[model samples]
Target: MEHRGFTALGGDCELFRIDLGGGTLAEGEAWVRQMHDRFTRFSESSELSQFNASAGDWVEVSAEMDALLRESLRAFDVSDGLVHAATLPALLAAGYTRDFSLGSTPTAMPPPPPRPLPELLSVRDGKARLAAGAAIDLGGIAKGWMADRLAERLGDNCLVNLCGDLFARGSGETGEGWPVGFGDRSVLLKDMAAATSGVTKRMWGPGLHHLIDPRTSRPAQTDLHEVSVLAATATDAEIYAKVALLKGSADAAKWLEGRAMGWSFV
Candidate 1:
């Protein structure tokens, strides 16, 4: 039997769904919608936004958010704070706050003031908590996590593509790996998720891009066009790809060598 999945992820376009020749797509779609409903800030009642909007010493969140934040923290240290959601304000300060569809170029107005890092953001009691006034942007890893969730909800016979950050289970009918290309450019194909991070055309200005270095509080100074990694988990591939791109190829290669994670740089 075949199934369908669909939802809107709140970043670029609505993350609508399309299922082909599948049965029980509604169950899968409903589960996917549940995820979207729980996560989308536009919904006005998402747990994340509620927590961010709430007034308390520490607003707590669900287990999923806790787990993902913990994973992100590990990535932060492993990548030397190069792959962090906490850097979103830095990104916006560098003229990257606009919607993705507006294109990848910076606006004419001066960039916003630099945003300070959170005083405390930690997981406690199986809940993710943020300090009273620390805003976060999970755009870096949320999509991959959603893809993972959808893949888990569905059996291992399909592919999950959240705006081209894709994850697949099992082989295609042709017995060949699912073809994944980066940035809607290039002819390369692989079985794993491929995430492309650059100052995308939308965030380019004064030789600056959205991807910032949390340690230095500036755009990362890396001589890499893109970085791609292959791993058992799509979340891993996404996180690694972003971290590698920020780390640049040299440091990334060293980091991967330490972890023994399969990767490629272009």
Candidate 2:
């Protein structure tokens, strides 16, 4: 059986089951909604939004939030700061203050200045301190994280695809693997996640989208429009995809040589 949904995480989402056993499909939906509510920056009441609003102050966060933030830091490190979570101001400057699913908003705002990683985050003891005048948007990592989390609840015969980030459990009905496709390639994945990032999607202004270059605090001028990476988890794949796109085709290939990653770029 399969189910599809839209308007969650500002993109299409789906769940597929094949002899599933661990958790009910409804439970998956509930978890998605809950995470969406907590992480979405479009709402003022969201935990992320509250954190963004509370700049220069230490705010307590739940375990999920702490984990997510730590993952963001890891993404920052792995990508060499090419991808980051604290890009709310940059996104707003690029005219992405509203949800892209509702269509684009073309208002003008000041672009965020480049910031060091230490200036972006200070997390300890289940609390985080956002630098003054800095804001964060977890949209980049949150969807992939949600995909990984949802995949854990399913039995050993299911697939979770949330906003193009995916996690599959066990092999498909044929026991080969679940096939996932992206630029110039298709991967048969079982008990793994695949995430693809693209600059072409979520366009707002002349050159703006969800992906931001931390150095310039604007849409990265990447040679590849899209890049896909397969990894053990969706968040890692998502981070790799973005980093690969930003590094272009050649460097991405070199970076993937020693890593257990399969990538396709265009």
Candidate 3:
């Protein structure tokens, strides 16, 4: 087996293609291109983008989007609503709204006094409802979901990486499973997705960053710098990471233990 890597789906995506029994490079490229055309949010016709823009009623969806949202919502419910996309405006108002840039001068943004949680959450007819004053930003689960889908599409012998997080389906020709490293943290994965969430990588304020504690409806005051969770799916890992970060190390560990999910905090 030979491994071929390429950038596709979008400029931000990275994919690895493994040729079982030594297939042509062109064939692998074509397969990747097809997957990107179907999966990338920029594809315009993807069911996800359509759903992202839909409002007011249950937007009828294909089975794929339906499954994605359904499973993602499980994370929402489990985190006690801590990890939510409807709070985008609140996140921005706290100074995390800007594109992440290193070495930039920190702004003198005032601390946003605590505000009431927006009434933008509700579920009806088996679908999540976005309240009149809420917005849906799927940055939390979108990438992980895409990686999971790509792993499924590639079957039992490939790896999929979205930005930094990675999910793998099987080992390569070297008889080693997918090995992914982020900064100083590296891990092996086999049919699993590892998602990381933290405030260390985001902009800093007086004592706050992007990770907000939705439990108190404020920026999380947890002292831990980072937290990573391992679960059956990337969506689970992603949600657990955020939930753990907001809940703090002890509470996060207890929560994961109760749920039987793997986690690490630093």
Top candidate when judged by lDDT against the true structure: 2
For model 3, what is the C-alpha lDDT against the true structure? 0.60
RMSD of 1: 5.0
In model 3, residue pairs whose N, Cα or C atoms come closer than 3 Å (at least 3 residues apart or on different chains), thus clashing, are none
Superposed by TM-score, candidate 2 places the C-alpha of residue 260 at a distance from the truth, in angstroms, of 4.6
Order of the predicted models by TM-score, top scorer first:
2, 1, 3
For model 1, the local distance difference test gives 0.59
**C-alpha-based local distance difference test score of model 2:** 0.80
TM-score of each: 0.73, 0.92, 0.70
Worst 10 residues of 1 by lDDT: 10-19
Cα deviation at 162, candidate 3, in Å, is 1.5
> Please, what are the lDDT tens digits per residue for candidate 3 over residues 158-196?
776665555767775465767766426666777777777
Question: 16, model 3: CA deviation in Å?
Answer: 2.4
Ranking by lDDT: 2, 3, 1
